[model samples]
Target: MEATISLTSQDVTKQDPTALFSPKNPIPMETIFLSNIDQAVVFPVETVFFFQVPPTKASSTLNICEVVKRAVAEVLLVPYYFMAGRLNFNHGSNRLELVCNNAGVMFVGATSRLALKDLGNLSLPNASFHRFIHRPGLYKSLDETPLFTIQVTRFKCGGFALGFMTNHAILDGKSASEMFHNLASICRGEGLKTHVFPNERTSLRARNPPQIKFPHNEYVKIPKIPSLATSFTTQNQTSPSPLIFSNKYDHKLFHFTPSMLKSLKDKAITKTSSFEAIVAHLWRARTKVVFGNTDELSTVLFAVDIRKKISPPLLAGFVGNGVVTAFATAKVRDLVERPFCFCVEKVREGGERVTSEYVRSVVDWLEVYKGIPSTCNGNNFYVSAWWKLPFNELDLGFGRLVHGGPIVSGNDEFVLLLEGNGGGINVWLGLEREKMKRFMNHVFDI
Candidate 1:
């Protein structure tokens, strides 16, 4: 059943959406060049953090939005000022760049009469949560789009939800987590004293005379058509569009306890980590249901942080995209019919191939191809593991964090592995209504 929610204008008020920077530490006006990895992800990634406060006298009158807005302006934005800028496509260079003219981000404040308990399981993905986020205009141009947008919605019980959106072109998961940690520290009045915020994009600059040493099979060149320039809208895009707004799929979560995880590792021929074991099982099961018994090829894609994998490693505090796609492929018959260990080995081998040389080759290949976008086929599956991220530790000085994860599963083919509350793994995914029923039944068959 769909959740029915109503938010009257009287219940929510708007503040200055452009005060995303600190006056003392003004953002410099300049264009920041981005790397191929940064350009690959053109869409904004949406996530939410839930906090619940005790029924105390101080909690009733506290304005959570104002507090957070102050923290963001006076502290968070100082080191991460690029987030307050807009994305601009440089036609001459044929690459996307950030124009840092101090264009501030959008911040919203809202209130609801409903209590946090009224919402079903907070751990699960819910469409109703979309109301808490400030969705950017998809049709807007890059120059007009804000790099970040946040919304704070207070519940009747003094609890609140912080919905955040950031352009993936600006930073990856690691950098985003670093920003959150800094924000949390600043909110507690400790103030930020971390490493100098690294914004050196040219450190990963493409090799001169672009050397395509390795075949980057993960990417394919786009057919030369009249280039109408890059648009913010994801319409008519390739598989796995940036943002998903369809209601044709069902979002569900699966839990894997430590004991269950150990069982999977023990079953494998060689010892494997939790990620390898869990993803291998999910890939095999999904391939079986999605492709049935067939000889067609199925591929699994995930990201591997390349911060230290590259030569002359990126700055320790590097805050740009520093991840490369690692993928494994197998025929449907082999992936489904074989034992779980086979898929596990394939996943492990794919990740192992991302050495320093391989990372360099990926960068050079993108340069040779003029930063062409990668395409995903129907048989491809994407998985992201966020169980180890420091989101649970983010204390904003208002309430304690109760739940945190992706706002919604982007697509049926995409799966997110997050840590459960009770020391287990929570696998959040979306699938067609009928297919989801089959997936849920088969998820634990191993």
Candidate 2:
């Protein structure tokens, strides 16, 4: 049976701040780096959430909408920056800036006669999943796209799912989760309360002379004598890189129970985080499946949150993009032939290497060479994990959520890890189809 969705209504909602930006009451328009990194690349973040809890007895179709609408209004009033800002080029510094203009957000509602189970097990959502989520189509420029959009789809089972699409440059996963928690609290009549949005933007700003102290090879290909690509590239630091189309890869999720994770860790060379061991295991298995009996160079680029890595760690509530991507490159033969512990050790060493100096260096590198295609290579595999993030407490009027994770992947060989049922974990992989059969066998064999 096919899943069918019918649109009930859709509209653009503007932010009504308690006070407007004026000469006397001006909100600082700090052009935070990486906040507008999308200026260089267009990889919009699309995430989805499905709630099994049927609406409360008092929750009618209109009541649900009003609940969301009011919650958003209250939450935006405090963190209204989400509603008023858009990315733009800062001519003075030659970079993208988070400028304030109440461009607003998009809200869409949909209804489906099919229940969640009738659609079968949701591994990776089918292509038609877009019909259930907010999709910001290609815009003339990044400035035209809204920072956030929401789509709430209700099923015949009386339950509902939420799809959220946000510009990566504006808010990272942490910020988005914080905002969601606020929304959920309001729906349950717990008057909206939120953490203080950190004012640490300037803390990570580039120096006036753009000094490069430590090594930041992960961010940019720092030339001996840096020559900003003033002529060949857009004068802006985060200018859009020339588009390079990607090959289609069938995406699917593989889940591992908590006990299985402990077993993998026990086999590690020298104890490592569950995340690191999983990455090493997947890297080895995927390498074997993708290029069997070959000696090609393969690289794994994984992202690390730097909130606690810096000398003076960022506050817990700090938001925006504070993640840095680091790499572990190895020959395919070595990756497949080496003991599993060898790879796990490599991950540990790589983590230790991204010190405060390394993070600072990356910031400098990006400031100098804005949109240089140096962060990732054609042979790289991307990895990110959100297993530790809290989403279970997002109790709007609905009970516990059944599922929540990204619906779209920006990388070709990307692997995303998220929390699964019980204490298990979900592994989402994007791979070429025929090879996926081999991947499944190897993944299960372990």
Candidate 3:
């Protein structure tokens, strides 16, 4: 009733010689620069999930490892066209490394019931997956292998969870999800006839000869002694403020019923736009219960994908960082004293100001102050909601996931949102252990 699947380079090589490289293509100079920048950031870390069915008359008929092997083979056959063309750190002298060449798939063997517990204890190999922003020049390859790792364990209830790790520079959340979906579909005898092609066209291209408007110098202010902490505290202290939430971290996906959605919209209408209003309301609710203070200062930040919002839509399938906007707002007193709806309104206004021009301004600001130490306001609370977007539609064909949630990138100051099947929202909140407990009690009680 138990099994393990392991795949290696030899198995992959035997299937296809063209697994990682393309002979006829050359990447452009600009793409190399973009890859370098992406390597500098740390948010887009890669991971994957597999939902296992219990061994039954029907389930036992299929060989899961064979399915995964086929999936890996398929991914290898195609060149990570983008990575293969770009050089690491924009060094023209260095050659681009194929994405598949840099990455490999590992199979961890464990029982289904203990899967989650096992994954919870698993840390990404320090040797393979290091935080990009924390350590510069550590990873050498342009499409450097991401020290990919995989773990398979059975759930207590006779199911399983497949966990994976990869570097953020190679893929964004959306892209990684797509790859896993395709792999799953192909593994299930679906076959890989239709390539789940990455969008590389105009919807993601950079501004031709990208211009710097405000310049990095204008917005980036470096502090004399940089403090790694980026969250606010009730008092000035060296350590970041602890997040207030219960210790039990459970992932739940729920849909907003028509009435609930309508009520939320009506509440938001009085104060901010739809997105901000909802985020603000959630922030206030969670903070109130966890912090035990209506007046604790906090901020909510979200992403604004600029592919369509830019002057001219970016090139389609461009596959680099194209998100340009983040929104934030906070109030210790206003949150405690003001009506919840009012607070929601303020958050809405703050988010709306992050237009294409604003995004350009921020980038320009970064360009000007490239190496300067900047003081970032860590005291504000952070919230990101990307559920309404196409994240859940990442159907790799074994039937859309019943639930899919985002993993926290070691950021203890924020809450993120994702889409859930059956029309609900999945909220991921990371706070101080003590605070998390209180917040969970409040939410579950409600």
Candidate 4:
């Protein structure tokens, strides 16, 4: 038998996308100013969560799309009504702001000719997963495009996939996950009746006198040369680096059992967390395979939740971009030649630096250097830990949440860490096809 059936664009038929509004509550028809960090991330983030048909008799007849659509329009939109707003550039502030005019979010319902099994191994990453998400098209401006879009694709076997695309300027990953949890809760009849989410964008606003205390090496005014080159000569040695072209990549899921993670932690210095230990291992391993020259510098960039890192702590209900980038940089020689603990300590120090004062400084820094983008090249490796996020527990009242994560990694220089079934960690990463073979050899050898 064939391992998996082919899923074509024709297999999935979508309904005419509709605009969904808050059915009962009337929100303020005003503009909300987004923070500098929010303005920095203007791109869209797409994620898909899969659910199997529930075993219970009552759930078997549930209309996954209708129920979810109703829950979003009636229950979720009250607090998260900002999601229905449109994004526009504010000429006065010279920044992008959200116009809370209740423009309504785009909701698309789809049906697939294939069943849940035909897609094959939902646990694995596949580019075809994009079929589940709805993009507003390439030509639309910010005001014309919907800040949030939801696509519900029902499978032949009654299983369903909940796909969402949100403007990063309005909501980050954490806030988006919570919104889904709220929707799921409503579908199960256990959701909040009067949920009021705190919009704390003003709290993170830049100070009148911006205080940029820390030297933010993460953001740069000018782009650097491509770190992974076809040929390069270090001070001590000369060699041709890996012939990895830009945009040609492959993604894979690397599973690490609890014991395997424990072993990694055991190998590192005492008190090293699984995240730090695993990241250190990945950084070192990828550097070994990609960087031929010892002197070449490699940087690991990751996001730090600043909700509690600031003074007085951001409110638990505060739902906006509450994350800042934290990174560690070291010479390829140091990462490869030094002991495993060396890399772990470097990773730890980066996180330790994200104190209350540091978060404020990050806000101020972005204020001064408006639109400064983070450095992204072969030398930069981005890591996002979603293991603690509530993806697995997101039961949309349809059935069991079998698997959930990014539809597909849009960037090759990125990695996503998610919680795995059976108490393990799943490393979903993308890399050049040739270097991946060498990376697999070095990842677990430590």
Candidate 5:
């Protein structure tokens, strides 16, 4: 039997006057633009995750829509103040505009205990909610409308997971996590006990922005399509057409033991590097497994947060986009032709080049090139290690999350670092279908 849940459009507008923005609490305009830039980089692509909630008495009493609305309201209140006072950039303050829409929900009936393992293979409905986000659009305007999509799907186990697709420009992964926790809390009839308060003192101060020391001359470059130029010329050219990369693939997590880490580290002495060096070595090993003798170039890119790297640390709890740099390494030869240690060393050197000065330079360049059409380096792969970062400790109340995965919608070349509960590293890789299969076989020696 299939289970069903539904929601009717309702004007659920709740605002805190204290959270309202005014000239008295004006934020720098540059900050707003930077926040949008941060969102553009991280978002542009959508992120989705599958959750398995075992049937419980709590699941039965859940009113999915009400829970979501209340949670969004609470979360918005916190960020509203943060954006009003704390969000800053080289240009000005970053203010957030909230536009909440009623995205329809769904219901899936089941006859027996649902096997979540199978849900992993199940595809949800293909509606405007999924399609509209896949396309690109102008996202820099502070007044651009915010969108939230919520869908409730019943499982074979008589439980449900609320699937949400939110624009990252509006909130980061951590902020969204907090919002979800609050939503869950409100669903359980728990009063808003701990309200979100902006850490104004630490969060609003402006540190010296990043300055590029050694600008990359060989950044991945994409030539402008003449068609795009014509489209913009003929139409309203204020917003550039959005670019979407096709990303459909399978992924799994791999754990490396401490002993294994030690082995890799010890091996690195011959190469003269640290843990990241050894990990890069392993990454090459995996790459070789997939590519065989290919001569095509492959790249590894990782994020470098600029919050603390600046002269003075950025204000704490600023709650907007703060990322400043991305470290990358690339090679063209077949993985088998290179020594694993050599590849590791190259990656290490590249990562070290991303310094506070380099970050500042990037910010400066962005400031100068705000409206100019820029090209992105089309690389074979991208990897981000959030495991060592504070992503795991994003506690909004339901205890620390055991696992967190990025809900990326349109890029195939990506990797995420996750912290396991038992003190291990979880590496989630998303690759193009054919390449991913080959890569998996190489990793497992299957």
Candidate 6:
């Protein structure tokens, strides 16, 4: 389903809130400390959402660019931090802060002749689909990149592809999607319903006099990789030459129906949860495919959202990094050779360790270490769930979305769990080229 999606004469312009603060009356100099979790990643998180049709005629007679430009201007009035904040690494001060500099977000427009049906089911993303984005990787410098950007590609069949890449330091998947939904509402004439107050990240910041009592063996420092080059393609399948793509990871989407997932849950070693069961199965399947034996050690990492779990609880619309990593370490043999429930129970235990107290301890631990964020290597396995997010709420004037999730790069080190259209789960797995092919075969065989 590949076609020319030419982005001709793209009017790339900054969409700031209707010129409120000028140079004469500049915004107040405000800065927020980026937490260790926020500073962990040096790359931007990219996502593309496809709609069934164009914006409703009743909504406006304006083109997609006009509609988006108008909507972004309005949305920025409320989520003003998005327009006002800029990332700056003070070499002299030795820190990264979100400087409220009244800067703006990037907006781009493009067109495609292909129809939604011609492209077939976009339940999963592939390589040719990368044209829908403007920037899919990290920028050279902080000033060169805005915290957020939007690219809309309209099709001839009355449909469009809306893609965005937001800096991970400013927003995670949860916060970024919410901002888009808010923008969608604005485009639909609903106006702003969200009351997001900026700078709430301080609540989760590392204490000045940091204290750490609980053990933090799970969060080992991520050793620097020799290479810093970034990739922009999602090698959805492996074929032709494995040697050419061997250096790049392969990604594929696997769907599990409601009945199938339920059956898996029932067959757990003990009374295991749905997530734990799936992670256990994947943990075993991946280990088996990659290493071919239970010889070497394998680790599975999952993040915990401490928004509500923390004491006193965080307020609504508190945009900041709130997730802490939790991981399980086991030998390949122990993971694949053991019973299903054995792996499930092990994963459960690892997650249980991320209690409120434990999360607070992590904050202090990071502060004590000067905010050196916890990093994961390619050898480790990480799982993230987007099923709970309000993905279906992306009603950008066109009824709802046809497909949505991340525009996963060619990195097999990450896995994303999304809600399927058939009341099930869609597992987007990225693995080594040959390992992915074998892993899919092994999963089907089971």
TM value for model 2: 0.81
Residue 82, model 1: lDDT of 77
Q: What does candidate 2's lDDT look like per residue over 343-427, in tens digits?
A: 8887776777788877776666667776433334433566768777676567776645777766643335457787776788888
**How many residue pairs clash in each candidate at the backbone level?**
0, 0, 56, 0, 33, 4
lDDT by candidate, in order shown: 0.75, 0.62, 0.42, 0.77, 0.41, 0.65
TM-scores for every predicted model: 0.90, 0.81, 0.62, 0.89, 0.60, 0.84
Model 4 spans with C-alpha error above 4 angstroms: 1-6, 24-28, 54-59, 191-194, 222-247, 371-375
Better of 1 and 5 by TM-score: 1
Candidate 6 displacement at residue 127 in angstroms:
3.4
lDDT string, candidate 4, 251-297, tens digits: 67888899998988988967899899999989998899888889988
Q: Candidate 6 local accuracy as lDDT?
A: 0.65
Residue lDDT tens for model 1, 1-446: 23434344554444435447544444347788899778766766788888888888437526777877888887777777778888887878877788877778788887766777766567776656766777667656678778889888888889988888888789788888888788778877788848588898997788887777877766545443223222122312432233355667777778899888888888787989988998898988888777765888777878898988888888897989888888888898998778888999999988999998898788888776643333244456678788866678888777788988876644565688988767889988777788878887788986
Which stretches in model 2 have alpha-carbon errors above 4 Å?
A: 1-42, 54-61, 122-127, 208-217, 220-247, 291-296, 371-376, 409-411
Better structure of 1 and 3 per TM-score: 1
Residues 1-446 of candidate 3 have per-residue lDDT tens digits of 11222222221111111222333234332243332223223322433343534345224413443444445645533433443332233234231222322223334434332423333312111111121111112233323333344443334434444445544445555555555555555656675534545434333223445565533311224333244443321111212222222234332223344355557767554633456655766666665654545455555555556656666666554455555435444566676567767767666666566567765555544433322212134334455565653444434333223333434444444556555335555555555566665666654321
Residue 120, model 5: lDDT of 38
Ranking by lDDT: 4, 1, 6, 2, 3, 5
Q: Name the Cα RMSD for model 3.
A: 9.1
TM-score winner between candidates 2 and 5: 2
Candidate with more favorable, higher lDDT: 5 or 6? 6
Model 5 Cα shift for residue 87 (angstroms): 15
